[model samples]
Target: MRCDGGKPACQQCVRAKKSDGCEYDDGKGKTRTQIMREHIARLESRIKELESPEITTPPITLFDPHAASPYFSESSSSSSHDSPGTTISLSASASPAPFPIGATADLESAHWDGQWSSMHDFPAVPQIGEPFGAEDPPLELAQMLLEIFLPHRHQCGLELHVGRLRESLTHPLSEQRHPVLMNAIYLWACFLSRPGQLYEHEGLYLSRALAAVNDAIANPAKAVDFIQASCLLSVYFLSNGRLLEGSYHASAAASLALQWGLHQIGRDDFVGSMSSERESTFRLEPAKDSIEQGERILAFWQVFNLDRCWSVALQRPATIPDSKHPWTAITTPWPQRMEDYETGEVDIGPGSPTIHAFFIHQAQVSNAIGGFSTFALHAKAAALLEGASRLSSSWSPQLSTSPSLTDNFRAFEHTITRFTTSLLPLHQLSATMPEDKYSLILIHSLAHASMIRLHEPFLDDQVSRDVALRAARSVTVVAKHIADGDFDYLDPLIGHCWVCAARVLISELAQLQTTWPPANTVDIRGELSTLLFSMNKLSSRFPLLAYQATKVQKLLDAN
Candidate 1:
């Protein structure tokens, strides 16, 4: 017998006179060319799969703005001001009137299509000096340095900071040795302290902060410090609109604080504990004033949960008041805690006082605004902040000077500006729907937008218009980021805020198209409607959005 390659077969096989070739010489091995061809075919298949259109659920398209309608119709009349046909010139010649009074008219005239490359102008990154002498300066100082040194570090800085924090957490400093430093580190990780450049970075910072706090907790000596750190981090998360994370941290911090009796510690010795036994054994003497302060911070974080589900008609499975698990108590008022404060005792009242105040104020405003929950929330938030300012000055002198305080105030101011700006558009929408229904929708949109815009201002009119136009285009973008499955990178609560803002924007854009002159009515309205439909589909989860999408659907159906 011979092998396939012409080599002699094994002697035993040859003796047997087997016709089949030896196993070793069967010639089953593939050539290099064949292997490469198979690889290329697999790669090509993969590329085609990547290039294929994603099989998404088709968007609902029930509205057609091009259909003929009587000018007297409610929808047509209400949106008259937005008609592209009625162009409102923004030139000096068009409106010679002075500043604030003519601001609206001026804004209208300046409006082009508002489409421009966003890369044209970006803010300069800030640079801060490194701290003197410390190998690992307090995290707070490090963050402050980052903010000061590279304020506009944007997404890059966020990534770097998260990396550094994660590394530090792996080898935490001795908890008993550096209370102040640890506190600073925890504060740095807080999401609110982060520069609001991109949503992704904010998420990274939040995750890192939570991880750091958890690491601290694992070390007994650092447990108390971790509590304070966690509480601050929770506040930061809530401020930045990461409600789920904020709630998680807030709940953890509040529980730990109660267990450790943090509110009982005297101002002078609060940061000195190291041993778990000693820390656990110490009982706080009730100090009503301090208790109120702690409560306020807690209350603020708690309100985020409520705000997250604000737009839903039916309560979500994860809503705040569901009794599946126990929740922290609502914070009590300051005046009620006066007895503990005057005596310098650790009263540490029922719950988070500051957050409670926020909710109370929100509820009051909601009741008064005739169901304009958003408006009432903002009005109340402003009031709560103003009240906080007064309380901080009286109860905690140092807090009044704290940079964190200043940051919070700035955030509050931004919130007010956003809410105030939304009033005009909301009022315009209210004219179309039933008074009560529209009022509720308008308030919700106003409050939600105001809250979000507080941090990221659209200072430039053109930029604002562009953002508004994008918002009008489709709710899909909003839904993808907000209501779509768990995107750990986004603050779920803040996502809701964005959804509300986008809804308002779409409504305003539609109104603008209708109110403009008849010259470009057909084209402009068509474009605006397409944009609006896209936005509507995206925000379909938030059915209570300011504009009556069902009305648009009916209009589409009629056509």
Candidate 2:
């Protein structure tokens, strides 16, 4: 219709200038033109911020401007952007642009390489007042924090681009900086830090993060950082017993994920134009289009994982409803390492597998595990336990009176049994695949935990009591060893496992001679002591575990 000043290209030779870009007769300001203009304005602001010398202040110049600035290399004034002596600032070391418009640099860090550093090397995080502005934490401290969080990043659903993160923090502006996400990251770092480091700054970081998260939730179209920030905050809150708040943030992330079209593989609703080249124009930095795309995929998966896990953990319905979305039809591939995405090593072709493939079938029935080689069985097992937990949480006095629950438990029991039995043999899981051993530990322990969850409700039956108690003791011994060994950090699901195990042990102890029948009163007090001690070990880091431990202690004291 461009032939006669129209959009549909009508079959007529008319001298209608298409250069003005085909405005329709229906609307003027309410079109893609306006959306594109908004994007352009954001891009322009980003460019101006990077170019302007007075935009951010320097704390301790990490790198020379000539070497660091991606654009012009001229040295800018060193004066603080804020009122003199009132604020601190930082700058990105890799230059204003860390990548070419559509791609990232070769991100080579020791993290993904063969060599690994001990996470204990981070500087102690001292207490700070309300962290209101860009008083950037030291560059060394930031790198150390990044390192400390790396071992547990996969479990935490953190998928930030290391190269870009490093550059952005090196020169952080007040608004340009993703302070909320930064605070959340630091909160985790502080949590994992040496004993007292956590208590000192956790509140400060959390206060700032929560405030920003609230703003982002109110206006989700703000930026990609909000999604990741919300995901991290949700995890932090849940791990520390902030259930209601955590669920709110997690649900908010889910809403934003859908609104931003993060669920689809090639979604362009946010991008006004169809061209990748045109879309790249909105980018704030040079990190590739793939980096942004990968972030969206990873971020959405993070939210999805949270929805499933917490729905079970908290005994609530999931925000990401499986019945409504094309979740099964999602073709998005599993997330590669951030380094791989940054360096353009993303293998999304026939060779690479989709993350959703992990849920298609149970264990050996489908080759999704091997199909997605980077897949962690602990994460998979956690998801299955969540499913079982969801079923267990359905126990109402009315529902409990019905016989249908037995059939449901039986079906789920068979599924979990098959999954546990199908695991790789010990000989197969070697030093090379160290993660496999931990995965096996978690899967096996949680599988036993699943049996308890499914059967404990019907404990009046001798068979159900035996099954639940057997699984309870099994997980206790196995989980204690896992907590003390190979895995650097156990996810919060593991704490829930401990909670269930403690309940069974405490309930059995309550019955004493009647339950034992004066025949098998073997020294069970020692076992109870061991379980309580193990729970104590984790309580310092996870307050929910502390709460569970306290409940158990009170029970034992009462008896």
lDDT of 1 by residue, 1-559 (tens): 2334433445544554431323333356554335544754454343233223253234222232324321113453344222323322211101111112224443234212111122112122222121112223334334342333222111111111223333443353331322322333423322222222221122223333433443455454444445545544544433322334445655665565545444222222222333233443534334235433433322333333233332121112222221111223322222212223334443333333323334434523322211232223333433332332332233343343467765664555554444444443433432221222222332343344443333223323465455444433332333332222212122223333344344445444455556636233354345435434533443322212212333343333333
Q: Model 1: residues >4 Å from true position, as ranges?
A: 1-135, 138-212, 218-228, 231-251, 254-329, 334-498, 504-559
Alpha-carbon lDDT, every model = 0.34, 0.55
Instruction: Report how far residue 8 has shifted in candidate 2, in Å.
Output: 63
Model 1 lDDT, full chain set: 0.34
Which digits, one per residue and each the tens of the lDDT, describe model 2 over residues 339-407?
456666554423212333444453333333222333334445655677677776677656435578767
The superposed Cα distance between candidate 2 and the true structure at residue 120, in angstroms, equals: 33
Model 2, stretches more than 4 Å misplaced?
1-135, 138-141, 160-164, 167-177, 194-199, 214-224, 263-294, 324-376, 393-407, 424-441, 483-488
Error of 2 at 327 (Å): 7.2
